[model samples]
Structures are given as C-alpha cells and as structure tokens.
Target: MTDSDRERWDARFTGLGPGEPGPPGALVGREHLVPASGRALDLACGRGTVAVWLARRGLEVDAVDVSPVGLAAGRAQAPEVHWIRADLDDGLPVTGPYDVIVCQRFRDPALHPALIGALAPGGLLVISVLSQAGDAGGPFRAPPGELLAAFGGLAVLHHAEGHGEESLVARG
Candidate 1:
C-alpha cells in the first residue's frame, strides 16, 4: 500500500480498541485442525487477536501489520506474540516455513504467491476476505470461486463464500 493508504489504516485502527482474543476465523469450529505445536504467521494482524490466540494454543506466532498503533495494542495484550510493523503491500517480510499461515480481512492478489510459499509442507493455510459472491459487495470483494481457484493445490478442509465473506481452510 502507499504511504497514504497505510496511514489510513493506522488511523482506522487507532480509533478502535483492541480486539477480543480469539482463534482464527477459519478455526472457529475446527480448532482440531491447528497443530498443538508449530509456528504461525498472521498477516495484516490487526490488534493481534488471532496471533495471540495462536500463541495461547502453544504455537509461536509472528503478527504483521502496517499500523503501529494496532501493533502496540496487541503487544500490550499479548506480549508473547512477535509483532512486526510492516507494509504488506511491499511484500511479506516473514521468511517462514510456518506450520500455519493466516491472512484475514486483507486482500491483495499480488501477495498470494508469497503466502503459499511461506507455508511449510503439510502446513495449514487459513484465509478469509470480503467477497461479492454471497453478498452484493463492491469491486474489492472476491467473486465466486476465487478462493478455490487461487488455492486449488492445497487439500481443502473447509470453504465458504457468502454473506459478504469468503473463508477457506486448507492444508498444503
């Protein structure tokens, strides 16, 4: 993202309070899919909700976001998580063979390859984004079948595109 775009995100997050602790959206009902021990990366991890949950689940976690304010809140709440301030638009800074990779509420097609490459063999990938499929959202949302086509190589555990959201849980 451009400097202005990142600043916008920072402003947005700054006005909001820290998020409640929680597991990744895709792992809500399927927590068993998460490995008991492994490394995790949370991209665009606003306020570190998912990152903190990963750490609580016994996984070392790296959480990245462009908003320093957001990272600060996360660090205050979950000091165990490694919070990295970075502009994901530049590219993922994490060099990972992470056991789990999560990208939530952030969409950038150009980063897909990097996300896939960061996952370890037999690793899990959890992604969720706004979608146009089930709801009449704007152009930023994904169209039908976008997630499946983008991550077809992985063994899908769950997939849903509707309600203005698209989510996928897969294993690479």
Candidate 2:
C-alpha cells in the first residue's frame, strides 16, 4: 500500500470506536484446531482482536497492520502482542514458522506463497476476505475459489465463498 493508503486507513481507524475482542472468525466453533501452545501471526490485524485472543490462549503472537491508529487501539487493550506497523505491499513484515497464521478481510495473491511458507508443518492457517463470487464485483475482491486454488498444497479443512466473503481453513 502507498503512503496515501496508509494515511487513509489511519484516519479511518482513528475515527472508530474501540475494537471488540474476538476470536478469529474461522476459529469460532473450531477452536479445538488451535494449538494450545505455539506462536501465531495475525496479518492485517485491524485492532488486534484476534491477536489478543490468541495470546490469551497461550500462544506467542505477532500482529501486523499498516495503520498506526489501529495499532494504538490494539496496544491499549492488548499490550502483550508484538505489533508491527508495515506496508504489506512491501511484503510480509515479519518472518515466521508459525503454528497459526490468520489474514482476514485482506487479499493479496502475492503473499499467498509466503503465507504457506510461514506455516510450520501441521500448522493451521485461517484466511477470509471479500469475494466477488457471491457479491457484486469489486477491484479488491477475489474471484471464485481463489483461496482454494492459491493454497491447494495445504490440507484444506473448509472452504466457502458467498455473501460477499470467502473463507478458508487449512492445515500445513
């Protein structure tokens, strides 16, 4: 993302209320899939909700997002998380052999390979993003089966696209 994009996101997040703590969407009912002890990374972790959630679950967590306002909000609530401010357009800001990696509401095909590579063997990956499959077309949305095709090498557990969203849960 460009500086303008970062500024825009910062502004938007700065104007928002506090973020609510919540588990990652994919881990809602499948919480058992999360390892009880291991490192996790949350990319585009908007206000550190999931990052905080993972840390509370006994996993070391690193959360990254480009917006400082968002990071600050996260920091206020979960200071335990290692928050990294980075423009992912420069590529992933943190390296990892993570047990759990989540990228929600963000799409970037270029990072697909890195995301797969970052996972440790048998690690879990949870991803969700806007999709054009069942929603009106948009420049930022993925086409049908995008996640399924991009991360085909992983052992897929669940995949769905509809209602303007596409979600995937898989293990490496």
Best by lDDT: 2
Candidate 1 weakest ten by summed lDDT: 9-18
> Best-fitting candidate, measured by TM-score?
2
If candidate 2 were superposed on the true structure by all CA atoms, what would the RMSD be? 1.1
Instruction: Score every model by TM-score.
Output: 0.94, 0.96
lDDT of 1 by residue, 1-172 (tens): 7888778888888867878889877789999999989999999998888888888889999999988988988898889898999988788898989999999989988888888899999999999989988787786898777888889889999998888999999998
Question: Which residues of candidate 1, in runs, are more than 4 Å off?
Answer: none
List ranges where model 2 is wrong by over 4 Å: 15-17
Write the residue-wise lDDT of candidate 2 on 12-50 in tens digits.
898675577778777689999999999999999887889
Which residue pairs clash in candidate 1? Answer: none
The all-Cα superposition gives candidate 1 an RMSD in Å to the true structure of 1.3
Q: What TM-score does candidate 1 reach?
A: 0.94
